[model samples]
Target: MDHDQINNQSRGAEGKDTKADGAAVAPQFSRDAVFPGEVVGEVTDLNRQDLEKQKAAQGSAHFHRLGWKRLTVVLIVEAIALGSLSLPAAFATLGMVPGVILCISLGLIAIYTSDVVGQVKLKFPHVSHYADAGQLMMGRFGYELVGAMFALQLTFLVSSHTLTGAIAFGNITNNGACSIVFAVVSAIILLILAIPPSFAEVAILGYIDFVSIILAIGITMIATGINKDSITTAPWSAWPQDGLTFAEAFIAITNIVFAYSFAICQFSFMDEMHTPSDYKKSIWALGLIEIFIYTLTGALIYAFVGQEVQSPALLSAGHTISKVAFGVGLPVIFISGSINTTVVGRYIHGRMYKDSIIRFINTKMGWITWLTLITVITVLAFIIAEAIPFFSELLSISSSLFISGFTFYFPAMMWFMLIREGSPFATHNLWKTALNGLCFVIGMIVLVCGTYASIVEIAHKFKTGAISSPFTCAALA
Candidate 1:
């Protein structure tokens, strides 16, 4: 079947049509399809303008704008943004050895799943977002469920970024303003930046963010190394007595996985690339660089700071240098997060404006609608950030609840569901079947176990004296 026919058939509201037997089936989208004006087919001249508009809306019309260099910078920034945030604390809590092992392991898993996403996208060019992928697998219902969950996941991630920004601001300002106020300030700033549509614009900020993340991490490492004496505790001492349980340990592991949490953005990134073929290379570059950085940063900081390492890690650096690190981090504090905000906005705008009369590019109403939607999302995320103000625990909850599925299971499921289409019992499909199935199962475990553990611990922190009331200035730094 051709692409449009597949989309039409999948728009049914109920379950997908199975064969006479019980096996699942997939849409007949080709994997190795090339660019526009290629051998895939021809476009009708009657609707040529509409087709171009559709291509622009879908992000393929601006392909050559983001070459391999720009995309690589974007991927690098995305991968390392949050990775530098919380991994040291994980290493501190889990002990250097186990924590490093888990960090590298999750990085490898991320690489494999990320590669899976690239493969799936190469096969199905229509999948510009996770929602599109779900639709291909299960029609309208699939798109609704996946889109909701995917948006929810990205929303929480944006909230996490906002919360982190609030903490960063609070750290610098020393509670001159309440954390809630800082969160709102950060949100408003993000709202303005996100108003201009298109990943191409954000990719420019991404280039700036790339430098910020690197400098921030590098300076933090230097300050920590030079002032190791200030940390009071030895670098590699087993802090079993600092009071962490196995559940908390697992939560730490999840946070490390959270550091590699850019999988959710891969489809959006690929969709905007000048040549989608360059994406696999970008994925490998991001995966390897992040693994090295996560391992090195986590081990080095935890070694020097020990249990003193904070979530942002900037806090535990030598006093003057901590300030410098935080200042350097300010770019990513807004822009890396703008990346998430941009992705979420694109998903919503794509859905609302795709086929509607309001989608007309020449209309002022379309621009107004787009700006209004982005503002609302940014505010809603701001509110959530203040409500769940605990930075580390919030990261844990977001990762366990959503990141596991997007970063691991969804890609695996996509591969398994589409690779063989309806041929479940084919001998040729057996090895792929086992691998994808196993990864899917692992994703589920991460979701279930990690969620339960994070929630329980977050509650315990609230009940005990460990955490303050939500929406407080309370020195979250």
Candidate 2:
């Protein structure tokens, strides 16, 4: 029988009010009836499409309408929120020369990982579904692990942002209001962000872009001029002491990469775009611009602020104006980005647990669960920040560990699986096996060394009186 005859018979099988027992029946017109060869054609087309999509998705390509200006704005927001805040620490760990080089190199890596490889994953429908990347790269177990990791990361990140928000609010008011204001304001922000509003509704995104850049640039100028004058009379030029080695420097660089690169989140966001193909070009452009910004900021901080300062001005004691900018700026980026990240994390987690006894874990529950988890995490962040002298250090170390596992380790393993499953056919680049393996190996080294360094520093601080909570802030002082 022809394809039309088969479809007509299938439609008639549902008892559509058609009077043809021998002849082909014209089924009642419904939305799905416009296409005649619906069932088999759909199944065949979907499978073929998915197969092609999987290949492209694994490449981490993406498509969209984001032009240079919009991309730059996004990078500026990210730079201020995540990169600029950590510039001082990077300089402290790597020194002026190595630190500048490391920042440039890692910034490039971050760009490639996020814009290039991550974009491929973002372009195709269903293929780029955050957890599906795990499945594609690994298998069922990989999917579960990615889901769990994402859930934890979101919980911790949201909490950290809330803490930052509370602290910023406290700075503005200066009445030690980080506690009450932190919880209430952060919860409200999360609620607003979690509703999945369009880019138009994300007014804070623009605020974040404007405020972060202004603050960073303003502080760089003031701090440079002031610190330069102070350091000029001192005559100590031999790379201010930090007591770090080559291996330590290498691990430091790795940690910086983990800090700057959020490719996993970038890949997952592909679903939000109307066109995924924009990824290949846009990501490269975004990465290049971000790298320049990050490199310049790091170099400026190192050259002006010197290694002796405890933290970045933004992190430490910014001028009243800069402080105000940072105080408000950090929270806007935090809540806005975290809400979207949480939504993705929850969706992945719900799917993983959907078939278990906890079958009620749908999208609605995902949001609720994510919100509750975020609230708890936020409280912990406040307590930790309040009590621990080295809380930022600990947070950075933990974040690195999280990225190492989720971004570096799991993806590497999955790519290996792809090789095993279909050799050259499954993954176009046979070299990925070697490249991914190297990343996994290097990641493991960073994980072990960085974690140990963090623990040791925490122990030292505890022996003294630097911090009250070891777990809350033990990375280093």
Candidate 3:
């Protein structure tokens, strides 16, 4: 059968016909077909139909309202954040040429992997999250494993933002309060912003989040350019640092990898798209935007500040301008951070109430559970942020361990196991197979080498008393 025929049969088997009251009326799939491990079961279709009914009943609670533009906005909210700020430091380590090359090349690879993810989602509409895709690829074991990774990675993302927020507050207020207090305030703001569970609703905040980061980065660039002459006259290099170690280099590379990890949440976001096929538009838009922003931010900031550039290039902008940049960037930090909580909350909420209208979050009970879940997520993230009171290492470790799978290897595997149409050795599929092989290799390399580098560096920092004690009031330098 053709692809469309297969899809039609699949849908028909899973009860495409539903009553107005959201009851499944069509014949169910055979037990053998449903449990064959190649497709999702009938229960998922019922849940989906039920969700549609709930969405229709609660008009404003609809989840499938995102268009391509809004999809891009939501992705930007997820992808671009403190990661951009860290690029300058990455650039400083790898030097100008490699930094720019990695920024462009890795971005292209990420775009390809994201396209594969979107294709899988379109093919299997029931795959609402990465974990669901995992189930399709590797059964129940895959489901649980990917689900845990999804939750932890998103929580790690939120924790990174929490850390960024505290740092921003500390810098903006010039250390006026204890760092722990700043962290608590940051967690509260994140919790509040994450209350809206819908991706469409979050996309609204994405506009402000995007503009906030852009203006902040723009201010930093202008400030740094103006102050370059008066600042340190250390010359920037076009090549890697003279004595960069393996650990140092991989840490920098992993930071760049971390920056392109929008793919990790693409499945979740695309699930909310009104036209899922329009994902290509959003993917290209986000990919180009990230490439431009990261390359420019890394190169310009590194050139201006040379080796003295901070991880967050904002601090490289003169003392006064750094504070201003942080002030302007608060929205992106909190809004972006909160969205992670929302994604995780949505996933958990959907799983917890798959058969109930409460998953839609339009009722009293839904709101209560959602609020409680997000609060718990935010608190856990805050604790993690304190436990790892540093920036670059946390990002590198998260990227190496999780983003490697989600962005690179997992999508590559998806293309091979779920999206490919024929044998790998077929003439038509030769180049694509090779490309996916390369992607898998790259992901594995990052997973192994990058993790080792991050751990080694972090351990060294701790051994040398370079990192502050967790939950300390000491100001971040």
Candidate 4:
């Protein structure tokens, strides 16, 4: 005759499983007990309406399920398409051995940090995208900073790809028609790629990614084997390898860092993946492939063109083959790279404009502004590449700083934060901490040294009146 008796009576009255006769009817429970809201027995019966609402809610979450194969493919494509062309140019500038080593080292660091970030996102599935990660992990400032950085990276990526295409287009077709053909074709390619919202879809991006890698690797192999004579290097002893100060080494390494900095894309790709567990395995495969390709290409370039050669990748691949491949691959690569950049940038942008900014410029105007800015930068890159024969050097140096920070430093710092904030001991085991520490220390050293070397090189150039400014470049005195 207590609470249990009341519950039993109520169930019986509702036809569940108890007695309902008045002779022993347990005390009539208050209407409040029957239903928490209205007065008396006016409360309606619980029926199909409630069940339907629950089902609908559960159904909405189904879209987030991702498949493992799709994720692996996307990550691999990102790594290969971005890494292949970039490594050759970087190695050419930094010298073969140093260039290859720097890429492998930084790539490993970037991969580890990204894994940590992935784990954090998995822990909080509700806040799973890049913008959310930035805000949740680092706060408002972090969100804004990451967004701006991503936007700039996209601009650089598009510009670089466009220029490479333009150069090849010019070289392959007619001499005078370079700029027009380059700009038009590259822009068209970008527009085509822009049709896809997520750009992670396999049909369009996978084709471009696969074809470009094949052509690039095939051309490189053919050119190197066919023209082996061009690749003979001096003995290790008599090599012009004497008197390279620490500054020189640092500057060279910086160029390599920039070339390899495409690590930020790894996170976006990973997050998009259906199964997060495959992230590490996919990374290892891509890293190993990059290491092998870059190592072989660098060695060949060193042997053939040596230090005196500019743009070794282009030269090593020869005039006809390199020109044709770049002519096609350049536009495709640029467009594909831009998509990844935009995804990262837009993700960041959404996080930043949460308040008034969202109200002000969240329409077509914002999209147009971003596109226009990228177009202008593309033009500037064309002019600069035309004027400065050593323009790749400039790209390598500046990009090194960006790559070092985005790929190595930022990820490591976030890992540190996650560990401190009481992530499971298993996730942040001792070996991981040590590895993260090693990556951080090495990345810092590379960043500092790379900066110093770039400064010295610029100073030397200015003294000789080589490049007057961003707008002007003239012969040395």
Find the candidate with the highest TM-score and give its number.
Answer: 3
Tell me the spans in candidate 2 whose CA falls farther than 4 Å from its real position: 1-83, 115-124, 175-187, 197-207, 231-242, 245-255, 315-322, 327-337, 344-394, 419-434, 469-477
- What tens-digit string does per-residue lDDT give for candidate 3 at 1-477? 355865787777666568878888745445555233434344465555655675657743388899999999999999998669989999989999999999999999999999999999989999989999999999999999999999999998888888789889999888999988998999999999999889998999999999999999999899989888887567688998678999999988988998899988898899888889999999999999999999999999899889888878888888899899999999999999999999999999999988877887887788899899999999999898888656557767777989899989999899999999999999999999999999999999999999899889889988898987888888865
Could you estimate the TM-score for every candidate? 0.82, 0.68, 0.87, 0.69
Off by over 4 Å in 4: 1-66, 81-103, 126-132, 178-181, 230-240, 245-247, 304-309, 352-394, 420-428, 468-477
Better of 2 and 3 by lDDT: 3
- Lowest summed lDDT window (length 10), candidate 1: 34-43
- Candidate 2 residue-wise lDDT at 431: 67
User: Candidate 1 — which pairs collide?
Assistant: 31-123, 63-274
Report clashes for each candidate as comma-separated counts: 2, 19, 0, 3
Tens-place lDDT digits, model 4, residues 89-148: 445445555665666776665556656666665666554354455666679987666656
Which window of ten consecutive residues has the lowest lDDT sum in model 3?
Answer: 34-43
- Cand. 4 Cα-lDDT: 0.55
Better of 1 and 2 by lDDT: 1
Q: Cα miss at 366, model 2 (Å)?
A: 10
Give the 10-residue window scoring lowest on summed lDDT in candidate 2. Answer: 468-477
